[model samples]
Target chain A: MTVEKTKTRLNIGADPREFQKRPSWTNEDILALLDEEDGTLDPRIYTDEDLYRLEQERVFGRAWILLGHETHVPKPGDFLTTYMGEDPVILVRQKDKSLRVFLNQCPHRGMRICRTDGGNAKSFTCSYHGWAYDLGGNLINVPYESEAFCSDFNKSEWGPTHARVETYKGLVFANWDKNAPTLLEYLSDATYYMDHMLDRTPAGTEVIGGMQKWVIPCNWKFAAEQFCSDMYHAGTVSHLSGIEAGLPEGMELSDTKIPTVGYQFRAKWGGHGTGFYVGEPGMMLAIMGPKVTEYWTDSEAANRAEKHLGSAERARQLMVQHMTVFPTCSFLPGINTVRTWQPRGPHETEIWAFTVVDADAPEEVKEEYRRQTLRTFSAGGVFEQDDGENWVEIQSVLRGHQARKRRFNIQMGKGRSGVGNKDFPGSIGYVYNEEAARGLYRQWIRMMTEPSWETLGP
Target chain B: MIDEKMRAATRQGDISLEALSLQHEVEQFYYREALLLDRHEFNDWFDLLDEDIRYFMPIRTNRTRREQKKLEYTKDNEFAHFDDDLTMMRGRQRKLMSDVGWSENPASRTRHIVGNVLIEEELSASELSVVSSFIVYRNRLERQVDIFAGERLDVLRRAENELGFKIAKRTIHIDQSTILSNNLSLFF
Candidate 1:
């Protein structure tokens, strides 16, 4: 009960803006990136709180977010609790067995109705006053409905406020904006790469286990950008493991790990990027050479596993680790898992990772797939923890007023462009370039400077 | 459930240490290993690992007996985190040594106090098994200090000449479920 009065309220419904801390993004700010010299990115993106609030409204609110995989809710009455850019969202199975997503806040007093992370409940009960709703998220009961309402209370009219829930392949997507493009339309070429992730399996992909969530203190942009292209800081500022993995130690920027071990692609299609050692030059191809198969073996075994799961064509198309969905979803196709990052505040983020497995794959393989997922992406996995320290430090250091002043450049391997394999599904840049981060900033600019979907007309 | 193999080894298996001669060598070896880590002598600490050493922090989980489906630690279990192999261990050590391994930049001056070293007293001649308790306290820059106290079960195997009886594997079982607030940045 004490958490009630002090808990940060989600209802900023009508509060006048009074938090005078930092400057918001302006058109001039985005245009600066167009210049080669003065257009460098300000480190303020990592620290500024006002910029974050604006982003939540401008970018996250507009982007088509990856919610969860379709495999989660199989039959009616099932539901899973997750957050979309910090808004609690409930993914439910309707009576028709179709899946739907809604804002998890109870319509009555704006209280979060469900506390359990996931469950198979017949209806939702608001813990505060026991206002209950059926599995369809329709208000079904109140302790004293007769006494409280004057007989005209229409539960149908008070049904859940709907969110735009859709999916591209097996990956479920939701949008706060009503008129956002179809998940596939928004995905565009990004979907081409997604096919390698989703369609490759025979029975299609399903979220294998419960989501992995960890609280991180960093700007969501910082975390999201880091997921795709913070490769420039690889050996030095970040990986303590990199240093331990025999990186010459110093705090020098150059000492940081470079994405040199992999290639990077900045997709022009959906403003998303995929960075990997999936045959990109300069990578430690020798060590990863034999195990090129997404999971354990070579590409052949990978293709074979794909065929075993579904179709040969699907397996052929999608056999690499190129799955970073726009805005927030990152799928390591090779690892067969998708990570959705929910930004809570300017300094805090919660990451959710879900692995996908073939429905028809052998139980041992499914179990093996589970083990493989554990090996790396899980919170305690080597790379997972390795990246955590850096993200945390990135969040913590932005606290410095002076330290946040200098402009950080994503100019690495910039002019080394024009390297594209037209046959490939997504944009291809030189392996290990920060071009992906540049693409992120570019999309960010579009969202910030663009008009709202409502005024633009349907 | 603890693997039947590890438990049986503790009961009877490749756990003979008479060849390495009881507490003396085992105590000295573990003490030396801890010293190398605390001192940041990573390369040297690496040398102490018997070439074939299997250094692992297999996850620790809380599984209740009455659960319908007898579940053990799996990938889905919330993995607080772990490190495996000399590569990762030394990787952490190297990061700590760096000017901005910030986690330990203001290096925590530590004293690894170890005690109650005991031999399993019943295993094969080639293997030497031992158990010891430890408390390591770390004090670094402007943050709260960290300490981890726990028991270690070790299996040492004698090798050819230059490679003497060395750690075949070392598994750390903490006294408490929660790690002492510090991420285990160093090997125990």
Candidate 2:
């Protein structure tokens, strides 16, 4: 191929030219930073700029990132503009009711084809050059094409790049890597944990409100890793004040006791992970108000969930659960606050969060879930306020050269993980463990170092 | 007192002396509220709200100009930043004052600049519809500074209290769709 052809292919999201612009850090150097067995992590991983760029290309580009729900664009012409890592993409519903995600950039002049967040659009015309694309992201018209361009100039050859789309229950996910594993294969054992919220009822789930977004000056991994493996924060000190203040009338802080019976699941294949307290409702009552707690744990809604999931543990017992589907998608099951930790840079993350509810739920139950999630997990949430503070402080501290040179400890529950839990699947460990964190970093190293899907694919 | 005669006169753009005095009193009430918030007198600030006050700040969205009227802001019963009743506000106050509320433990220094005070309508003999613009500046931990500019639609009611008026309702409309601050840890 000519150099011009190669450049065109690169711009249109063909196999990225990883070998030409390789960073100084080798596979061995990246591997040395993370010691999975000893459970230690070098602080440089959170602060390095080169590593961040590699993550965007390798991890986010290959991973099946959760974009939105099916209900987000239920109609034929509906669309939602969101991000796949730093790359802007438009998720649109076609005339056949199928979903497609394509780079929002116009292939001609590289201007965004859809500037609005989301709406029904039969065709998107680029505001900069008047190049038009159909809902499927096919270039249909170029202004003065017959007059200015050669007769052989084809619109099909200049369409924006498209990503592979898939849905697990109602959640829509998109992937740019054609060679990567299918969504289910990539999710692996994580699906069992994801179903606790997404597939709790036969009616499935629907997003409650418009997305709530805010920027936190912290690494995306901090938010992703905490959701994946750090239930330890909740059981201990991080949320005590917020929980105490949110307790219902007649309930004292002293009256509540932390439940010790819970398990954390680290996905055996993928980096996905979740931790939940079994048969516990006290913490749920504090975080998600009483009405929502009742709806989630004791109401007919709970009964329906148990019947649909075919297990009482998944339906009624897993309270205040947190999970991350690898990279950036994270959510809380009972609270039903789903979010993507969109990485802005090495030191900043934009959080886009939304609540979801069972479609068949009563209006009051749905409303309660909406209200409770806002109070507990949205941008201005009492509990969420504490989390951002911790992440921001840690990121700020990493600004120091001395701070970036130190090796941090990740040895919370190193040897306690094993398989064969009856109610759960994948590698099981105690709720307050860093086993999942090890799994997450382990996967991160593999993605950062491996050049192609031949070695990385499941 | 804001009786029906005065309200009718104000509505007709007559600008009665009572109307002028009431407007001045309303503006002063806002300045006093701003002072309490800036001084970290949260309890005193709470006292200025009615027991049944609805403090709401809805999430905003980016939509096409044609759809702005319908989809620009989240509707009532939808997710919002601060959809608080009295109980919820009290809970927030408790968290703000608590020892372990790390977000506020080393409390942020803030300036609540209130301006553009407008009494939109006299809804009833005791209640008045008011609108005001604000620019809140918060500086924390040496160099972290966040400036929030927003307009508030408020319902102020005459009350037999020290402040002479209670904020019965407030709907905050922030200018940005995506909040730049890490968290809305402090009141707007």
Candidate 3:
């Protein structure tokens, strides 16, 4: 399908290492890393420095990355500094109350214009030089601009690069590729699953607290892929200790059962995916405790969500749902912990996590969400502790030469997936399946290789 | 427990023998508590905490200088590293002792170096507000090692039990905005 590539003023700065020559991997080499039909993946995808650099340009450069929630920048001049790939960008609220994302770097010497995590600011002045930028990222002042240069030196031409900003419900996203599809188009059928957490109430979702930042030594995709499709880990082993420890009073381990009846949704177009138990809140009860479980399933807020979503399955029964919107953004619906797996390097990921509750919910419910998410999913959370252990161990093992040569077995529920489910959208599969994982890699490959929006856009 | 009156009392000089004895007792309590934690004597360490204890660790943030006082650390009712009450702390203790807590399965060797103790307030005859700095060093499976440095604001209650004091409340202020460790599997 032919499509016109939209013009984007976002300037992805020149590669800082452009002077150095490095070993190259062709598109054919990148394509061979994942065997979609075979469901086997090369380990190098998680370790190679060169491949990681390419991903910064091809995958992260084009995809719409989740930066922050709208609640973070409620008033005009409010801004939050975040990363789109390795490149730092500032998500700022304009004077018109619209949002704009621009590179945090100063155009003069490539120093960051804003250093603080987030706060309201009239303009960002670079610490390196006296260059200043308006809320809209327009170059407003430069040190000795008129005196140091000729009359032809234009101040307007030297502003930091700007990214195309959009919001899906209350979540803000920024994209650098001008040719890429809009955020909604990029999200596609995945919005059905996303609305479970996001569009639950008419008042929409609000972040419960400030962002909790932590570092994990692992590939970013490991966290992304698991959130997209790895419910298998939760049921079989990873969270058993957490569940047993978090069991409600008067309840025994024998009373708790893992839910089997569920569906995994793999987006037909985008790489987004989510898996959830259909009728059981057993896992939810264990992880989020009884208060959050009751509020999520049987409370007035949940009833409103059921009416608002128009699907009982999504609002009430889809318990303990884990999801990823391609590349990096991930969240749990019932647990309500939204996060971005900010890729640091080939071997490390910086996680910025926060909890969100329906804005219209009572104070007690909101406080319950904050407390429960802290206990169950934050940096020191019970379930969260196990996840990082597995990832870090795997990453450590991959340091071996033989380990890098072996292929990962991702062939779970391969031929068992089908489209056009009656209740769910997208390609539906069993909850304990890796069909979504394959879909994630397939889209990753497509984004890595496809050069034009004519082929990549919807 | 630390009221304005108690805070004011802490600043006033009181070099009486009673004060010196109480100071030595509090320091000894901390050293023993650190030893119990380092020895993986979790249940013993658990006994050192009051049943109504509030163990908390706020998530630190990098904010502008003007906003630092209000926004540098997460608030009491907000997201934090460890916002555990007695029941939650019990759950964590239970998880650690269990076989399936993979993060600590092989069991990290930890040494909680606690020092710089100062009595911040004398809340009552039975309660005292104490502040101390600690450096917790953990060495996990193979080459994984982490060092966490933080200051703890604690309210210690004098008890009739053998331990002499119990931690009624503890608020840990870790130095880093972004935690360098993978997970806080071990306690501070």
Against the native complex, each candidate's DockQ, computed on alpha carbons, is 0.14, 0.77, 0.75
- Residues A314-401 of candidate 1: C-alpha lDDT, one tens digit per residue: 3433333444666788866656767887787877777777678766655655655554454445554434545655666666777875
Q: Score each candidate by Cα lDDT.
A: 0.60, 0.87, 0.88
lDDT of 3 by residue, A5-59 (tens): 1222433344345336346778887888888777788888999899999999999
Q: Stretches of candidate 3 above 4 Å error? A: A1-22, B1-11
Error of 3 at A289 (Å): 1.3
Comparison by TM-score, 1 against 2, better one? 2
Worst 10 residues of 1 chain A by lDDT: A281-290
Q: What is the lDDT of residue B99 in candidate 3?
A: 89
Give me the displacement of residue A55 in model 3, in angstroms: 0.3
Better of 1 and 2 by lDDT: 2
Which candidate should be chosen as best, given TM-score against the real structure? 2
Look at candidate 2 and tell me the lDDT of residue B39: 96
Measured with C-alpha atoms, the lDDT of residue A21 in candidate 1 is 24
How good is model 2 by TM-score? 0.95
